[model samples]
Target: MEQGLALGMGLDVGRREEEEAASADEEDGEVRRSVEPAVPLKLLPLLPVPRQPSPPLLRFPSSTATRNLDASTRGIDTNRAPSTEEAEEASSSSPNRAVSSFRTGFSAQRGSAERGGVAERASSILSDEEENGLAKKKLRLSKEQSAFLEESFKEHKTLNPRQKLALAKQLNLRPRQVEVWFQNRRARTKLKQTEVDCEYLKRCCRTLTEENRCLQKEVAELRALKSTHPFYMHLPATTLSMCPSCERVASTPATAAADHRPSSFAALFSKPTPAAPRQPPDNFRPQPPAATGHSCT
Candidate 1:
């Protein structure tokens, strides 16, 4: 009986513990339900559904529409209006006709543009030639005009604008023409002066060259004489003298007398013979001798 009582107490304790755990779990669930928000089913937005792709619709033209399209295409492809038979043929060979027609059209357009450019260029060139021909026309001056211009140029090499205008009026020529004539005259004068100066310089150069050549030849001849006759170069130079009273010819340093001197030492003491007197010319007459203080015996 005591054992049964103990087992019944233990069972009651276990049941009370289980009851406490269940109460705690219920409180937690209540707190959770109070904290969370509640939404109505009708207030929520619905998700969109993805659409599927549909196949494309194709509509083929009728036979009449096809014929009409071919006829229009052929008309555009050809330059002239196409007949019914040609249109049919073009339609039969549509691809080739289209290619050939495109090439021909492009070439024709290019040719036309090129021709227009060439024509424009030719016209411009012709206009330019006409303008240049008018601008560059040559005028001939009469003898009076030339003579007057020459006289004016002789007075003054250059002309003032007023002078140029006056000259042009007097000569019945344009001022530009007058100015050109003066310019040409000055150029011709300068050219002629330059030619004269050039000729003078050439003559001077030739003269100097000839002089130099002659001097060189003289130097060469002198050098040859020295080389050939070295003794003549070494010989002492001698000059001739005349005594006024006796009119005798005397050689200064006497080259011939020295040559005739003896080689022996004894000849140094020999008395030298005097040279003969020079003869007077046949046309000359001797004057009488002047008297001296002492008379000759």
Candidate 2:
């Protein structure tokens, strides 16, 4: 009987443990259901996740890669001999290559021609510049040079070859330039002298004209005086007398000297004559005239 009671108690304890395990399972299912999302997880759309940046890589060229790069660069040498395969390829395309080479040579020739033309133009421009420089040098002289030349000209109007050479050296000028300056200076001096002489001749002509006009007027006055005074023109010849002191001929008016001349003549006639001899002469007289022998008796 004790054995039966123990089995019944063991069966009741196993039942209680089974019920507690089932209740715990039901509470866990309820908690899981409440924590779940409203929408099903399988029905939601997915998004891509952002990845983190990776570290930079530092890669170096291997020896074989560097050799390949060098070979590729050196394969383009223009003077290098072609390989057998390349020669064959070039032969196959020889006509095209020939056309391209001809075009290149023609373009090179055209470029050279253009360069030659440019050089020629540059040479012409340089020549023009040189000509302009020479012209400027010839045309323009400084004040000091001009003054020196002027002083030399004052000292000598004309220059011999030796003198011109000396002056050119002293003034730092060419002999031709000095000679030309002297020639122009002499021309100017001669022209100035000619002008002065012309002015003097004009003054002399004016003075002579005035003198001639005055002489003509005096001659006209003398002619009029002679024509108006007929008595002065026709004075008697006897009225002319000579002065003993001055020995010059003088003339008196005939009417005024006539009465004086007759008075002087009468005074000359009235002058006394000498008286006759007296009785002394009768006493002194001796005899009558003596007769000749042949007188008639």
Candidate 3:
């Protein structure tokens, strides 16, 4: 409140003095007051802030930027592409995979299959020899090879010791392999032969047994027929003369003797008696009834 009053009074007094001085032409008692102060002033220093160096500019080289730009322009696929198995192998392999190497591998495997097949086909010893003809040339036994072959051939019945040696020497294979091969071949042949023999025996047994059973049944039927008919047993021995074609028994020797024309005489026998001709007595006739019936019965 006091400060406000003092400021107001100072302002009023300055204003009144200015008004009185403007109208004081001959007045000796008029006083003038100034709104400006005439006191000694103290100076306060303004502080200056210390200057600091700016941070260093970070920048990439033009080549690096250009590389990134070019990479982007090419595409994400080029930058992030996955490598193939072949490519990885090529990179990792020491000597590298040559075209010739693949061919060699294929040929080696094919040769092995062919060799195994040829060695196993054993219908006859000769069959094996024939199949192995090329193999023999290919693996002819050197002295060392012969030793190996001999070692292997011991296990096989089909392969001669000489053949085994020849094969071993020519093949540049170990005697053990030759032995194993021959052993396997022999085993296979034996198994097949045994199977065939078993089948043959089974069939033979079946046929024989069937025939035997049939004979037994026939014997039983004959016994039954004899028991059923008393007339069949009472038949005369002459009546037992049998016709070869139909096996019908004849009733009497006279009829049987008359029927005894040879097969070549069938044409005459088959013809009927001629009406115009009178037949002469035949030279052939039965001896005593007992003798005539002997051969016929």
Question: Number of the top candidate by TM-score?
Answer: 1
Which has the higher lDDT value, candidate number 1 or candidate number 3? 1
**How many clashes does each candidate structure show, in the order listed?**
0, 0, 8
Model 2, 117-188: lDDT tens digits are 432432211122222222112234456667888887776566544455456667655454566677788889
lDDT of 3 by residue, 112-133 (tens): 4345343343211222232222
Ranking, lDDT, top scorer first: 1, 2, 3
Q: What is the lDDT of residue 140 in candidate 1?
A: 54
Give model 3's TM-score versus the native structure.
Answer: 0.29
TM for every model, in the order presented, reads 0.35, 0.33, 0.29
Clashing residue pairs in candidate 1 (N, C-alpha, C atoms within 3 angstroms): none
Candidate 2 segments exceeding 4 Å error? 1-140, 231-297
- Number of the candidate with higher lDDT, 1 or 2: 1
